[model samples]
Each structure stands twice: as C-alpha cells, then as structure tokens.
Target: MFYISCTYKIMATFLYKCRDVGYDCGFEFSAHSRDDLMPRIRIHSRYAHNIYEMTDEMKKKVEEAIKQID
Candidate 1:
C-alpha cells in the first residue's frame, strides 16, 4: 500500500519506425522499455526481412531511432 502510494508514473515508451531505418517494411513497435521491444523487433526482422544479425552499431542506430512518448 505504501509503495503504491509512493509510486510515480513512469513514462518510458519506446517507438520505432521501419521506414525511418530506410525500409519499406511498414512495421512499427511500441513498448514501455527497450528490453521489451527488442525481442519482438528481432524476430520480426529475421522472419519478415531475413535480417539475421544486428551489429552493435546497428543496435545503436535502432536505439537512436526510438522515440519517447509521454
């Protein structure tokens, strides 16, 4: 009860657009955290686009592409 009362709203949404990454994939994903969003994006990238691997720089690019929504 105390914890709940003390809790503040966390606005931690992440947004990614496939087109922003120069793809016609037309896919977008949103989640509360990067950890929550990456797995789904990885699976989608692999199965849908045959993108099997993401380099550290590519991961950084993806992270850069993410937008925060309040």
Candidate 2:
C-alpha cells in the first residue's frame, strides 16, 4: 500500500479603507498581502489627500486600520 500527503495554503486578503483612517472619502483597497497594499495606499494618500509624506502618527493610524480578511 502507498499513501500520499498534500498541503494547501490559504491566502488572506488584506483590506484598508480611507474612512478607517479618518478620511471622509470612500476609498477601499485589498491585496493578498500587506506588502502590496501599502504602496497603493501611499500613492492614494499622496494624490488624493495631498499627503506627500506620511508622518509617524499617520503611519501608526494607517497600520491600525488595516484588516485581514480570510
């Protein structure tokens, strides 16, 4: 008799909402990983909100607002 084993990996989607970060705009982003989501958020912040540079406090707020969806 022979036996085989397989493994499956599930990717969790990361979500960020502009409203979560105190923005009235209804902007939402989702990515398979946090690494990918952040760049998009930064770009949006720069162009839409005129946030050329994100301060440490803003960074913390953004981090706190990110959610992981399975």
Candidate 3:
C-alpha cells in the first residue's frame, strides 16, 4: 500500500526488561517486520518500557543482557 511504500524501515525498541521479578521478563528492541509491530519483542504489563530506558544501573544491566542476545 501507499503507507508501506513510504516507510523505508522502522527501528525496534525493546520497550522493557522482564527480570528480578517472579518470572523471566523483559523486551528486546528489534525492528518490526512487514507483518509484525515488534519483530523480536513481546509486550507485557510488567516491563512497561525497555530496561535500557530505565535510569537505575541495575535495571539497565538487565536490559543490556537482553540486547547482547540480539
């Protein structure tokens, strides 16, 4: 479609990191493909935002680990 043509590409943003809680948690910021909004991440209520976005050093560390995987 016209919109698709206009968009060259979209950068993925790991909206959050899922860790230090009851279960493994967090998100990875990998660009979305044609059929996906976030190609490599899944949304969860706990994460809220990418762990990297967090100001806390410890939390950021968690996010960094996720990034390394990508």
Candidate 4:
C-alpha cells in the first residue's frame, strides 16, 4: 500500500468516495505516471479516516479506469 499526501500543486482533483484498491475517503492520485491515459490516476491509501466501502457504480468506474492501464 502506498501513502500519498495531497496538495493543489500535485492534486488536481479530489474524488470523494471512490472505490478501487480498497475503500474511499478522498481519491488521491498522481498523474505524473499516467498522464497519457484518460483521467489518469494512481490511487493512494493515505486517507486520515477509514475509506467508505465502494458502491457498485463507483467500483465499476474505478475498475474500468484502472484496466485502461498497462
């Protein structure tokens, strides 16, 4: 598991309640590696609180988004 601290300079968007790697608090990712892909994201599990469980729709979006990668 990776831990990422977010700031405006590095964090362009904050998706609340996102579900993929595990649960959801605020989806924090780094575009530095996935800049070439659609809504490129690198998930982080550094949330201060427990991530809310993922819903079916949210899970699908996350899985789809992740599958687009190498």
Which numbered prediction scores highest in TM-score against the true structure? 2
Model 3 segments beyond 4 Å from truth? 1-7, 20-56, 66-70
Residue pairs whose backbone atoms clash in candidate 4? none
Candidate 2 ranges with C-alpha deviation above 4 Å: 1-7
Better of 3 and 4 by TM-score: 4
Q: What is candidate 3's CA lDDT for residue 11?
A: 56
Candidate 2: the clashing residue pairs are: none
Candidate ranking under TM-score, highest first, comes to 2, 1, 4, 3
lDDT of 4: 0.43
User: Compared with the true structure, what per-residue lDDT tens digits does model 2 show for residues 1-70?
Assistant: 8999989898899999999989999999999988998899999999999999999999999999999998
Clashing pairs in 1: none
Candidate 3 residue-wise lDDT, 4-67, digit = tens: 4465554543333345333454433432332242223334423454433334654445444443
Q: What local lDDT does model 3 show for residue 25?
A: 41
lDDT of 1 by residue, 1-70 (tens): 3554476888789898877777787899999997888898889879988989998877888888788887
Residue 55 Cα positional deviation in candidate 2, in Å, after optimal superposition: 0.2
Which is the leading candidate under lDDT?
2
RMSD (Cα, Å) for all candidates, in order, is 4.1, 2.0, 9.9, 14.8
Off by over 4 Å in 1: 1-10
Q: How high is the lDDT of residue 52 in model 1?
A: 99
- lDDT for model 1 comes to 0.84
- Residue pairs clashing in model 3 are 14-29, 15-49, 15-50, 16-49, 16-50, 17-26, 18-25, 18-26
